[model samples]
Target: MTLRRGACLLMGFALLGGCNLSLPLQGRAPQEVSHRTSSFEPLAEAPQSEILSNLIQRRSVIAEDSALGDVARVALSSGARPSEAKLRTAKLRAEAENKNWLPTIGPVVSLTSLGDVLASLVVDQVLFDHGRKKAEREFAWADVEVAAVTLSQDMNDRVFTALSLYVTALRGQEKAQVGDRAMRQMRAFNRIVAGRVTGGVSNLGDLRMVEDKTQSILSMRDTAKDEATAALAELEAMTGTRFDGQPVAALAGLHDDGGAPLEVLKADAEAKRSVAQATIQRASLLPGLNASGTVSNSGSSATLEASGETGIGLGTGGKLKAIEASKETARRQVAEAQEDAARKQSRLEQRIASQQRQQAEAQRLAQQGQETYRLFQAQFRAGQRSVLEVVNVYEQSVRRALEGVDAKYDVILAQLELARDMGLLADGDAI
Candidate 1:
């Protein structure tokens, strides 16, 4: 009898030692990525607006999207920001969930109906559960992945927004300067028309027309100035810095786009989400085995209760139908993500091409404007055209030049966006 008891003890020990154990959330997660510094160098003849843009990018804390991602992580860890704190809590909850899969162990004391007291070392383990625990763990891991990628996407969006704002603001400043030049030309025309009226060479109606034109140009100048002001204010709010009106150079020399095609990226993103959910659903459909062992001693008697419960249930159509449905939903979402990614890739490429065409068109217009100014000059030398006509053509030329500048920037912006979509913003100037 003693040998039999010793054998039972040895078998229980072996079972306990042989059970497979898994912990899902035992290590630290990866941190946010950092962006490279800007490589903008202002030339002596650079526009003031462009120079301010460079300054803002170099000095502002919110300039780099990755830097903001880091701030978000730090805030989440510190529980300082409300949104970040919630993410932190969710991450902690995911890590804590892994603890549920571990075996339960403790000391037990029981009193029987016959007034006998017993003491035992108790252990309960899930010997086999059809990979339910693993599936759940993988699901939890998916949540972490979703959160991480969500943060990255958000930061990328922020970078694009900042870039758009800065470019628009700089463009507004340049266009406002063009308006100023138009106003000056109108002022000179007004003077010349006044002199002609005094000399009886021009009628009051013609003088009135020129004065009205001057007034319109002045209004346009004011409107342009207001637009520039508003754009600068928006940029200031975004970067938390003052943006004084300074000349800035046109955007040029974009970095190389180094990233996978949009199709691959989208598929990868969807897979991460779907696989986790599928794991959870599949795990829930399998049978589970729960086992427990107790070795109790009371006075001259020893008792052993070795028991287990195994459960098998219908899964896809019965016990786990809800889980299966959820898995299907995840699949659908992956399909949608793929479609959206393809659409985005096509649209971005078209925009890059369109911007190039616009740049070419603007150059042609600038040339046409110069030709018009030259023709007016020739007409003036023949005493057939007024100086105002030549000056108006010159204004148009400057306007086209401004448009060309903006068009070039648009091309650069499109390229940057293409890089962003390819996940290559990590290498170049992102914001």
Candidate 2:
């Protein structure tokens, strides 16, 4: 063909194919993607308000002017997590895949019969692909959803870690305070025993026992101090912030209300992804139709093409059926994930309730022990009870007090655990 004739033919082909060419092509999903249906009620792409609102509200309450808030904000701002990077990558892939429906322009080089190279520019658009392109787009979007959930999971986990460390440090400090008070009381007992022994009113053995108790309390105080220092250092390292006197915020209203857990969302995303992949695999076993327009130095051509696997066998039918079955499997997996999350949340709630009860009981016993210790001290002063008996009562009171502290922190840790599992420790937008 003449150069001018080829140019006109190419222009005609271009105009014909331009009908499907849409601008602002990136980041647009195909409207009729199959995986997007009512079956997936809590769609992976759905707004996270329901899922994260309770936690977000809780954060609003406690995250300001609190240690937990500082730790979370600092940790989140420290750097991009691996999951965040993955989400970014998935977003890019989805954007690229969103434009998959658009025409592709590329150079084609071939050897002619005269042993000469021919160069042409080809523009190809999918006229029909058994919905393969749609499946691809769905897959890419699903991947993005999964990555988003992962990012949420990772961020929540990070915040949970920092908060847990803070809680640990707090627990250690409280224990150390308890130990210090106990040590002071024990030292007073030791002084009394020493004075009695020197006056021959008490034996040396009594003074030795009192000294041992004092040393034990001192050891406990030192251990607790060490723990607090270690936990504080680690928390500082993770959040890149120095934690001075951050108060522990009450986690009373941080429980999950009713929403999809991160695990369920991740499963839903994976299910849609699996179904989309199955569709693509099934399409691959079949054929795809494409329209192509080529402009070359020597000629111009327009053609419709159908392409598929280079080889086909009887097993192709079985493969296609297996691919179809995988869709059901993916759906079942999502249901399983939901069940698992429900069971886990129930267990965590039960644990929190149990810890709260234990804490209350411990505080009650601790108060009663304090009254008993006061009564014993009065008896000892009146010469009705021995120093040993008074000392034992004091020890019991201290033990009960320590138990109350432990139980209180246990509840906090359990609540934090529940929040982490629910993906509610960090705000969804923050993730």
Candidate 3:
């Protein structure tokens, strides 16, 4: 029997080793991926109005459409041609110029007919001005820049809105949680009061008061639920996805470190804006280069007739002038982009500072609430306080706790907003 037991124990040890028991065990209870446990969880799905605002500012439907429309206008106004059209036009013009200079080489065709063919080619080539081509390229480039900037701005704004919604929702959810706890406590007190009245230890008045307070808590809870629902809907609309009713992930605790310097960011944006403007201005002064070839055959005799020309040509006219005109426009765009960046930076700093102050005030209030609760508890325990007094103190404590959570969320939101304004946040950081 002892031998058998030893063998069984050895087998168990082997099985345990095979099971990789050395791996660290997860501390949380088994749960679905959708289920989350955090005071800030509900707010995770909450819509951030700020992120929406930012998205609207950066990449709204109107802005995207406008950018596209501008690109189209640039293409049209600049007379930018498709690659094939440009190649054909270049070839035709080059052939025309060549015919104008070089005598037609073909079978013994009439000199009068050759002269007519050469004249036609020259007319076609001369009709397309060099300035027009240059202007088209410049306009195309400007349109590209406009589209890029609009897209970037749109993405930035959406992220900001998502972050704002997330934080606000989290604040509201935390308040709801506090209210839930308060209601539970109030219900328990109501039960206790009922038992006391039944046992003749408490009067009818006490029971009725406790009941009324419980009803009041329920009312507050309903209001919070409504607010949370609205926030969730808003969040869903922005993200264009559904959340499984999970809470938002908690942000790291606040640190005393200040936000990034707005002046530095403004300077960076200004520098880039200047570069963009320079590119636009330079586009106007430069002439474009193109090469083309063409083959044509005209029958002047029963035997045969053939002519061809291949060469390079430079043309300049209306388009180049338009590009020159756009230099001032490009400079203005750079100035506007720089000013906007600067304004954003300043606003971010001010918002962070303001949120930090609010958080400090909230912490103070939470501390005061705790102190008051302790005093009230002591008095109630000594039978020096009524049940109503105890309930009020508890409710106050709950409110204070909710306020503290909200303040923390606000700080997180402010940080997120600052990050967004700096273009640090990505799509994955939407929450």
Two-way lDDT contest, 2 vs 3, winner: 2
Off by over 4 Å in 3: 1-132, 192-212, 233-241, 244-333, 427-431
lDDT of 3: 0.49
lDDT of 1 by residue, 1-431 (tens): 54456347546644553566522244657745646422222222212322213222322222233433332223222322233334355456556655546656677788989898777766566666666666665555445434434433444445555555555666667766777877786777778778988998877877787776667666766765676678668756665655454433322433433333334443454555466666555555555566665555532222334332334534345636665566677667767766787788789779888888999999999889878888987997798997566656766676687788679768756765765464433322332
lDDT of each: 0.56, 0.77, 0.49
Q: Pick the candidate with the highest lDDT.
A: 2
Off by over 4 Å in 2: 1-61, 111-117, 255-257
Query: How well does candidate 2 match the true structure in TM-score terms?
Result: 0.87
Backbone Cα, N, C clashes tallied per candidate: 9, 0, 28
Residues forming the 10-long window of minimal summed lDDT in candidate 3: 119-128
Residue 414 alpha-carbon offset, candidate 1, angstroms: 3.0
TM-score of each: 0.68, 0.87, 0.51
Model 1 — which ten-residue stretch has the worst lDDT? 38-47
RMSD (Cα, Å) of model 2 = 5.8
**lDDT of candidate 2?**
0.77
